[model samples]
Structures are given as C-alpha cells and as structure tokens.
Target: MAPTIPGFDYQRVQVADGIALNTAVGGSGSPIVLLHGFPQTHLMWRHVAAALAADHTVICPDLRGYGASDKPADPDGVSYAKRTMAADVVALARALGHERFALAGHDRGALVAMRAGLDHPAAITLLACLDVLPTLDMWQVLRGTSATVGFHLYLMAQPPGLPEQLIAAAPDAFFGHFLDIWSQRPEAITPDVRAAYLDACRAAVPSIVADYRASAGIDVAHDQADRDAGNQLRMPVTVLQQDWGALLGFDARALWSAWAPDLAHTTVNCGHFMAEEAPEQITAELRKLMAR
Candidate 1:
C-alpha cells in the first residue's frame, strides 16, 4: 500500500474530464491546498499538512501525472502545461467545495501555484511557494556553470521520445537521484516514503517528462506573456526558499517582487526538500503566511 498522511482521508476527485486527482483531505475550518513537487507525492506534505490541519482544512493532492493521480496521455504539447496543471488545482479545490482557498506548492507545484495566482487571482486568497523561481525568471537566471545544478531540467525538457526512453530504462536511478540528494535531513523521508516516491515516478515516467517539457516551452511562453502584460499575483504571497541566489548569481527577492507586490520572501537554510527537512520551520512559515 502507498504510504499516506496520517489522519487524512484519501479520495479521487475529478478535476477535468477523464482526469481525477488522487487527493488527501484533512483537518477542518478554512481550506489550504498543498501541491507536491517533482519526484514526490502528496506525502511530501505529511509533516506540514498534519500541523496545518489543526486550525485549517488541509488538502493534498498527487498532481496529474504524479503519484496516484490520473496520467492522461499528452498528445498535444499543452496537456501538461503549468496552466493546465494550475487549472487542475483550481478545479480540484472547487470540486472539494472551496470557492476560494489558501494555496501552497513546492517546486513544480510552486510553478503551477504561481500560474494559478496569476490566472485565477480571485480564487486564491493567499499564496506560498516553496523553493523555486517563476519559470521565466528561472530560465533567465540559469546561465554558465551555475546552470549545471539543474541538469535534470534540461534533460527532461528535450523532445519527448528520447527523454522518456532514457528515463524509463533506469527509472529508479533517475528519480532516486533527486530523492537521495535534495534533502539535508534525508531521514525525514524514511524508507517507505522513498519507496513510494520512486514507485510513483517509475510508473509515471512519460507523463512526468511531458510535464517538464512543457515547463521549458509552453510554460515559459505563458509566463512571458504575463510578464509583458505587467501582471502580478493578486494575493498575499510568501516564498520560502534556499539561499540559492548567490550561487546562481541572481536576487530571488527582486525576481519574486516583480511578480508579487505583497510578498514575503525568506532565505532558508534547509535543503531543496525544505518541507520535509524543516517542516517545523515550514509549518511556522506557512501559518505566518496564512495569518497575513
């Protein structure tokens, strides 16, 4: 059986025609939906969700193309677009009876949340993004040797067939690479959680690759259009990120501020998997964000 969030009830909710998200809903009161990052399932929020559940209705979902969620074939390039995934998130919340809710996402899910904040501004009352830059700023800042840190981003962004075949041949090693190294507190994931993540990623290789490919192409274009139009997040936004800016040669605050006028950007010391490595800190940060 897949490892799950303690005290959380799991269900499959239809977010789009023929696409239902595997979601875990817990707690009570105001709603806050947490979206998981790449190489992870909703289980990544195991610690934070439980804490937030105390005073809020916490929703966690395996995004389409990841975990137990439906992975529809992406024949058209836009299928796995962040816009599409953002729409899935909005739909998931609406299906769960939340017309407006707080939103938080880690990594790839953060990208989707960012898009949702721009596209469906009125629906998201508060926004929190964990450890990532908006797509357009991300591409703009990654340059020279500093860019080597994101080799997987470029690898998966390649044309469809090759990326899928290469990753499928060694799914464990490929997905495990991220799960193994991205955390300072590796023990936070535990063995069962690691197994669950690898299993999910292995089973959803094609769709996962398509999702990354979309980030490189259509996702970037969408962000650019939003930027060109002077659009910004309409809600109170909080960003908890590793201090990767100096290494990558860019100011995370400046980049994020361009998009979020009411922003709380913090430089965290935890590893890439901050939600797991520093759940206490993250949980505190999230509570602070929601309180705003």
Candidate 2:
C-alpha cells in the first residue's frame, strides 16, 4: 500500500474530464493547497502538511503526471503545460469547496503555482513557491556551467520518443539521483519513501516526459506572453530558494521582483527539498504567508 499522511483522508478528485487527481484533504480552517514537484508525489508534503492541518484545511495533490494521479497522454505537450496543470489545481480547490485559497508549491509544482497566480489571480489569495523562479527567469539563468547541474531539464526537454525510452529503462536510478542530490537531510527521505517515489516515476514515464517537454516549449511561451503584457502576480507572494542566484551570479530577488510586485523572497540554507529537511521553518513561513 502507498504511504499516506496521518489523519488525512485520500480521494480521487476529478479536476477535469478524464483527469482525476489523487488528493489528500485534512484539517479544518481556511483552505491551503499544496502541490508536489517532480520525482515525488504529495507524499513529499507529509511533514509540512500535517503541521499546517492544525489551523488550515491542507490539501495535497499529486500533480497531473505524478504519483497516483491520472496521467493523460499529451503528444504535443499542451495538456501537461504548467498553465493546464495550474488549471487542474484551481479546479481541484473549487471542487473541494474552496473558491479561493492559499497556494504553495515545490519545484515543478512551484512552476504550476506561479502560473496559477498569474492566470487565475482572483482564485489564489496568496502564493508561496518553495524553490523555483518564474519560468522565463529560470530559462534565462541557465547559461554555461551553471546549467550542468540541471542536465535533467535539458535531457527530458527533448522530443517524446528517446527521453521516454531512456527514463523508462532506468527510472529508479534517474529519480533517485535527484532525491540523493537535492536533499540536505538525505535521511528525511526514508527508504520506504524513496521506493515509493521511484515506483511512481517508473510507472508514469511518458506523462512525466511530457510534463518536462511542456516546460521547455509551451510553458515558456505562456510565461513570455505574460511577461510581455506586463502582467504580475497581484497577490502577496513569498519565495524560498537555496541561494542558487548568489552562486550563479544573478540577482534572485531582482528576477522575482519583475513578476511579483508584492513579494517576499528569501534565500534558504537548506537544500532544494526544504519542506522535508526543514519542515518547521517551511511550516512557519507558510503560516506567515497565509496570515499576510
């Protein structure tokens, strides 16, 4: 059986036609939806969600292509675009009886949250992105050797055929590589959790590739159009990142400022998986954001 968040009830929620998200809903106060990133599921929010559940209705959902969620085939990558994924999130929240809610996302889910904040601004009361920049800013910062660490981004961004085949052949190793490298506290992801992530990724290879491919193609276009139109996230936005901007020699705050006029950006000391490694800090920050 898949591991579950303690005290949380699991359900398969239909966010769109033929696309039902595997979701966990818990707690009782105002709603706050959390979106998980790549190589993992809503399970990544195990620690933080439990804490947030005390004072908020914490909703955790596996993004469309990951975990126990339905993985719709997207040959042209449109269905998996962050815009589409963001829509899934909005729809999920509404179905769960929340017309407006606080939103938080980690990694790829952060991309989805960012898009949602822009496209569905009225629906998201506040936005918190765990460890990512805007899609356009993310692509802009990828230059020279700094981009090497993000090799997987380029690898999976390729056309459907080969990337799917390659990842399918060694899904565990590929997925495990991120879990090993991206966490400051490797122990946070126990053996069971690691195995669950690998198993999910292994089963959803094609849709997973489509998710990344969309980031490279259609997602970027949506971001560019938003940027060109002078659109900004109107809601309060907070970003927590690993100081990659300082190491990569770009102003992280400056890049995020363009998109989030009312923004609070912080460079965290923990690794990319902040929620797991520093659950208390993440929970505190999230509560602070929601209160704002």
Candidate 3:
C-alpha cells in the first residue's frame, strides 16, 4: 500500500470537471486544509496533520498536478495556474462538507493557499503560508547573485519542450536535488518516504513543469493584477519563513504585509521543509493562527 497518514481515511474527490484530488482527512471539529509542497505529497504533512487532527478536521491533499492527484494538461498555459489549483482546494473542502475552514500550505502548496485566500475570502477563515514569498514579491526580490538559488524557477519557466526534456532526462537527479538540499534535517525524510517522493515526482514531470511555467507566466499576471487593484488577504494571516531576507537582502515581512493586511510573520530557524523538520513549532504556530 502507498504510505499514508496512519489513522486518516483517504478518498479522491472531484474538484473540477474531470479532476479529482487524492485527499486524506481525519479528526472532526473546525476544519483546516493543509496543502503539500513540491517533490512531496500530502504525506509530507503526516506528522503535522496527525497533531492537528486531535482537535481540528485536518485535510491534506496533493495539489492538482502532484502526488496521487489528477495531472491535467496545460494546453492553454492556465490549467496549472495557482488560481486553478486554489479553486481545486476550495472545491475539495466544500465537497467534504466544509463551507468555511482555516487553510495552510507549504512551498508550492502555500502559493495555492495564498491565491485561495485572495480569491475566496469568505471561504477561508484564516490563512497560513510557510516559507515562500508571494509570486510578485518573489520575482521582485531576486536580483544579482541571490537569484541563483531559484534557478529551478527559471528553468521550468521556459517554453515547454526543453525544460521537460531536460528534467525528464535524469528525473531523480532533478527532483532529488531539491529534496537533498532544501532540508536541514536529512534524517527527517526516511528512505521509504524519500523513495515515495521521488516516484511521484518522476511520474508527474510534465504537469509539474507546467505548474511552474504558469507561475512564471499567468501566476505573475494574476499577482500583478491583484496588486494593481489593492487586493489583499482579508482573513487573519500567519507567515512562517526561513531568513531568506538576511541572505537575499529584502524584508520578507514587509513584502508579505503588502498582500496580507492582517499579518503575523515569523522567521523560522529550520530549513525550507519546516513542516517536517519542526512539526511541533509549525503546529504551535498554526494553532495560534487559527485562534485569531
């Protein structure tokens, strides 16, 4: 059997016309959905989700193009946009009988949660994003040698064929590169979990690339539009991030404040994969976010 969140029940719920997300749900009161990040599945939340499941109905799903979820083709370059994936998440929650819920996401998944909070304010009671800046700010902050760290973003943002061809040529090396470097606690991801992450990412290369490509294209445009209109996340928002600002030379909290009016930003000491590296701290911060 595929690795799962031990006690949580799993199901595939249709979130769009022909697309359904593989979701794991547990616990009972006050729902809060957790979206997983790149090169990892909903299983990344196994530790955090289980803890939250004690008091909250925790919903963890592989985003539309990752893990066991549906990977739709990006024929129009908008299919894998964060807006589309965010809608998938909102739909998934409603399908499971939640009209409103707190939402949190990590890395790529955090991007989706941010979009959802902007587009569906009434449905999201509170929001938490882990270790990423908004798309607009992200593009703005990277300059000079600092931008080198995000080379994957540039690579996948290229026009279709080449990026896909290159990554697929040596799938493990490409995906594993992030898995290896992004974690401060290497032992946090065991061999079995590492294998699962690699297997899923290898099979979903095209869709995953399309997802990143949209961020460089349509996602940027969406963020730009929101900024132009003074759109902001209405709910109470919590942002947990590594000290990218210290190294990259930008105020992370100030940038996030532009998009989230009611914001509480915390700089974490852990690596990018803080959900796995510091679940206790993540859980505490999340509980605090929801209590707001």
Candidate 4:
C-alpha cells in the first residue's frame, strides 16, 4: 500500500467550466497548489503535502484526465491542450477562495503550471516545476540516442487511436513500465501503489492519449508562440530536474534559464519521480522556495 500521510482530507470542488475536480487539501495559511503528473493523482503529493500543510494551505489536485476528476470525451481538436488545462487550475483555485496563490506541478502538471505562469502571471505569486523542461525545449533537445530514453513520449504522441488501443489492451504493463523505470528505488513503489497507478491509467486511457496528442500539436504551437514573443515567467520560478538530458550533452540549467528569466535551476539527486523517490528533499526545496 502507498504510505499514508496523516491529516489530509480529500474533497471535490466544482469549477466554472462545469468540471468537478477531486482535490486533496490540508494545512492553513497561504494557498500552495500542487499538481500531479501523468499516471498519478493528487495522491502522489500525499507525503509532501502533509509537510507543507504545517505552515501553508497545500492544495493538490489530480489534473483533469488523470485521476478522480471528470474524464470527459476527448474533443476532435482542442480539449486536452495544456493551456486549457492550466485555465482549469486557475478557476479551481479561485473557487476555493484563493485569488492569488503559489503554484507547483510535476511532469504533466509541470507543463500546466508553466502555462499558468505564462498566461496568468498576476495570479501566481510563485512557480515551482519538478523534473521537466518546457515542452518546446524538450522537443528541440530530442536527438538520436537521447530521444530513445523517452520512447513513451513518441508512443503516446502517435496519432490518437493507436496508443489508446494498445495501452488499453495491456494497461498494467504499459503504466507499470514507467513506474518501474523512472524510479531509482523500485522498492519505494509497493505492489499496491503500482496497482493503484495501473488502475488510474486503465480508466484514463482516452483522456491521457488526448493529453499527449495535444502536447505534440497545439501545445507545441503555444510554447513556440511564447518563445516567439520572448515571454518568460515573471514570478520567482524554481526548477528541479534529474540528469536525464545531461547524457545527451545538454546543460539542463542553461536550457531552462533561456525560458525562465527569474529562475533558480538546480539538480536533485533523485530519479524522475522526485516527490515520491525523495519526499524529504522535495519538501525541503519547497519550503525554501516558499520562504522566498
């Protein structure tokens, strides 16, 4: 079973766009929104959220498609764009009575958080991204051998139906591969936790595919436009990433610095799932960022 974090309560809140998002909220001070990555839910933040709850209101939400949130049918062209998803986070926080809040996201959530900071700078007081670069930078950096390391991206980026169908056929193996490979310490993800992740992915295939599909298309367009406009995150931005691209001969900090002008890029010794693999270190970085 996944290790339980004490004192956190789960609840659902209705946002303006007719979507009801299941959110796990705890603590009681300035609001800090925590967004989870792909194949996981608000539950991924369970350990780290409790630590933040002591001095801040930590709000963790399963981004629209991945967890207990309303999983709607994917529209023909535009539904799963990260920009649109970012808007959901914005409205959800406002509905929860936070006009201005700090934002943080991991993996897929990190993409949405990037959009939130870019599109709604006035609303986000601080921005923290865990283990990902901007989508455009990611695509630009993809090369021969380095690209192979992230084969899942290409698999998911395929033209719709194929990925969903194949993944649906063997959901456990499909999602479990990421859980096994991304973590340096596989023992951290107990069998039950793996099962829960597989279950979430099995139920969320179409939406998840739509998310990746959008990333390959519209999401790329949006990021490119931001680059063209010379836009950078105006708020204090912190990024933590493992050395995935270092082997590809790219400097992670230099690439990230190009996108986020007010940025503090650092290397964390954890694996891809930094929050889960090293919750204490993740929590410590979060505390330090909050202080700034």
RMSD of 1: 0.7
Model 4, range 161-222, lDDT digits (tens) per residue? 88898999998888888887889988766676667777778889999988988888899999
Cα error, candidate 4, residue 181 (Å): 0.7
Which is superior by TM-score, 2 or 4?
Answer: 2
Q: Give the TM-score of candidate 1.
A: 0.99
Flag clash pairs in model 2: none
In terms of lDDT, model 1 sits at 0.94
Q: Worst lDDT window (10 residues) for model 1?
A: 179-188
Instruction: Please list the residue runs of candidate 4 whose C-alpha ends up more than 4 Å from where it truly belongs after superposition.
Output: 1-5
Model 1 clash pairs are none
| Global lDDT of model 4 | 0.86
TM-score, candidate number 4: 0.96
For each candidate, give its TM-score against the true structure: 0.99, 0.98, 0.99, 0.96
Of candidate 3, the 10-residue stretch with the lowest lDDT total is 1-10
Candidate 3, after superposition: displacement of residue 149 in Å? Answer: 0.4
* Cα misplacement distance, residue 1 of candidate 2 (Å): 1.5
Q: How close is candidate 2 to the true structure, as a TM-score?
A: 0.98
The regions of model 3 sitting more than 4 angstroms off are none
